[model samples]
Target: MERSPSAQADLRGGVIWIALGAGIAVLSWRMDRLEHMHVNPYTVPGLVPGLLGAGLVVLGALLAWRTIHGGALARVAAPVGVDRIGDFRVVATGALCILYATLLIGHLPFWLATTIFVFVFTAAFDYKERRTAGTLARGLVVALIAAAATAAAVSLVFEDLFLVRLP
Candidate 1:
């Protein structure tokens, strides 16, 4: 039976996720073990990433299975309307991610880069809605707080707690 376009897209996404996760697991597993330092097994560099990769694999498998054998595959629904605004948002988000990775990482400290990215991302997405409601300032304040909190948490957790150096 022919699957809907959304189901097909889900299947493709699931496959991609599985592939990406498998790659991450493999690479992470091959990372330095620090045998000389005799680090605890739980503290191995690959431990967390390997778990995350495994999680992705499991989730991807579920997505693919659902797409293949669940209601999405069984139904014969009409084509859904496409939202151009949603598409624009996706493109805009992707552009922001690209900018963060390419331009922000090396030039700025991790916390600062993260702060800017999160703030811009939040503000950019919420600007129109907040402006329409005449609450742009409040939205900006909220976004800034969220951005600062995220940056601080990430920096503290990774650098101070986990001892992982940030770029």
Candidate 2:
């Protein structure tokens, strides 16, 4: 029974997730409840987050267990090379999201910002698969359509259906 690199990585990641979830649950528990306002106990500020944290902890533990002793127990003759491009894309997407949330949201109109973000993100990722000029142009068109459609759907859902304000 040999452990693959993925399994070892998963075991490590699962432990981190378990710790993060527990910390979230603890913080949620320590949050103040608006007893003076006679807010319903079920409607406590931390209720949903607390439940989510507990769920994360449970799932993380299960992941760790499975990686160490379950399907990941299969033996492998050689380690595979890490996908640098894929990793870069993941980090880039995360950074793009953070920028969109922190810098773009209020600075630009919500629909416009969302459209631009989606367009750029889609084009950047899509370029990996099809790098030719024609394909790139087609990808941009596709990205534009996707961005417009997504923006419209989100605006309708939040503004009309949910009645929530967009930044």
Candidate 3:
């Protein structure tokens, strides 16, 4: 039987997700293996990734099943021109945030770095627009809370609990 374009896209997306999940699982397994020498068996480095990978695998499997059995999917309207620019901007902003977190966190204090990261990243995404004030405010609040909680957690886990030092 012939399928609609949306169905074909769903099938393609499901296949892609499944492949990605498989890759993640493989990498997690490899990391787990390598971590054996450094990490105690009870504290496995791959534990989180392994679980996430497994979840992704299951989700991908479900998507694939829906695509195959649920009949033709609905067609989504493509956004006319200029939408690609926003997409690229989002991608670029994410990459920049990751780079800043990975490379600059060492040089700057956690709170200071995180605040700047949040503000700059938010502004980068055009959060200055009137409609975005609420979102930006929410984002800032969440970022602050998350950063504080993360710092406290790390301190408690490494300093008080595990006796490890933070970088």
Candidate 4:
């Protein structure tokens, strides 16, 4: 008979996701077919993304329907103590990722850009545990190694194994 604020929030998010997924699927359908290149019909450039978008739409619709069926909006609209700082951190992380993808990827070497991105992300997130004097060095070393390893693994997978081109 009652629901929490979180349920209402999830309902709202599900609607947004549904709309986004539909838009993506539509755009994907409208993309160029590259018929001139004699590409295989099954291997169309938008095939995977379009399918993903459809999947999202279905999943989001299911989520919204589930929330509604659960009577998410039936409860009183009580104020939930929102984590503004955590939200800010999430937004900042997204911005950093966008920067890494758009500005860094094409301009710099793939390995170097990926390494820097991974290292900075790791260090920034782990700052609290690394604040102490004794563990600081160890933390930094670990982060550096992790970053390098991640970069190498990614490079090997995309460049060598998948034969995908990297900028």
Candidate 5:
């Protein structure tokens, strides 16, 4: 018997979700194990990742069940369009931002690094309206405030609270 298109799409989505979930679980487990070298033994860094991984695993199981029992095979058979330009731009920008942060962290100081990063990242998404000077002014003000707040929070957490030095 032929299955419906929606059913097939659901099955495909289920498979994709399951695969992603498995990947996340594996990475989370690895991260949890690696974070054990921190000063406090009782302070488990892996807890967050472990919980997230478990949640993903449960979600994957539910998706798989729905795909199997809800007749989703037909939906998975549909043809889909690919948009490579947007995907490439997103990946490239993300990589550039990561590289920028790593290289600038120690050299530029936290406040400068963070301010520049926030401005560049926010502007990159075209969030700043060019026609409205007020909008741009507001965006810059907000970015500066946020950057300062982030720096303060980091300083408080690492320096004052944990007595750890920032790089």
Candidate 6:
């Protein structure tokens, strides 16, 4: 009658995903419809985001349902520490996102802002592992390459391919 840690974790994760997805969906729906631009109906700015949010909602619901059907709530088990992404990581990630969106995006060239954000974020989260392995320098190099590539790719897709202006 007791569920394992994985089951409990799944349930919690599913709920979190559901909540996050719903938030995204609502925000996406509220995004400007570009009525003035008279853009193609299919190219509405929020279409992709709304679809992504809907998918997330569906997947999260499935995860929650599966966990419940598997007897996660049959009986409560003693709380055990779940080795999930720690609270600090979550907070740091949120802070970095806010900084990138607010300070980096509009103030700097899109590519430059993205490059800096990605590099800093990657280096910050990856340093501890690299330090233990005595590869901090290599990690930094890798992070730089990754950041550049990410920026280039995003810029190309959004600006060139999608023809969307970047702030």
Q: On a 0 to 100 scale, what is the lDDT of residue 19 in model 5?
A: 76
**Deviation (Å) of 13 in candidate 1:** 13
How much is 92 displaced in model 5, in angstroms?
A: 4.6
Ranking by lDDT: 6, 1, 4, 2, 3, 5
**For every model shown, what is its TM-score relative to the native structure?**
0.53, 0.53, 0.39, 0.53, 0.42, 0.51
| lDDT (CA) per prediction | 0.89, 0.87, 0.68, 0.88, 0.66, 0.91
lDDT of 5 by residue, 7-113 (tens): 55655676777777777767766664444366564555666766776777678678778777866543445444545666677796987688666887888876667
Off by over 4 Å in 6: 1-85
Better of 1 and 3 by TM-score: 1
Clashes of 3: 0
Each candidate's number of clashing pairs is 0, 0, 0, 0, 10, 0
Look at candidate 2 and tell me the lDDT of residue 100.
93
Query: Could you tell which candidate, 1 or 5, scores higher by TM-score?
Result: 1
Provide the lDDT at 125 for model 1: 96
- Candidate 4's C-alpha lDDT? 0.88
Task: Score residue 75 of candidate 4 by CA lDDT.
Answer: 74
The TM-score obtained by model 1 is 0.53
Can you write out model 1's per-residue Cα lDDT over 1-167, one digit (the tens) per residue?
24346876788888989998898889889999888999887799998898898889889988998888866657675567677787799899999999999999889999899999999999999999999999999999999999999999999999999999888
- What is the lDDT, from 0 to 100, of the residue 160 in candidate 5? 82
Report lDDT (Cα) of residue 81, candidate 2: 73
Clashing pairs in 3: none
The lDDT leader among the candidates is: 6
Instruction: Assess candidate 5 and give its TM-score to the true structure.
Output: 0.42
Lowest-lDDT window of 10 residues in candidate 4?
Answer: 1-10
Would you give me the overall lDDT of model 5? Answer: 0.66
Per-residue C-alpha lDDT of model 3 across residues 108-138, encoded as one tens digit per residue: 7654665566556655554555235557666
Task: Compute the lDDT of residue 29 as modeled in candidate 4.
Answer: 98
Locate the minimum summed-lDDT window of 10 residues in model 2.
70-79
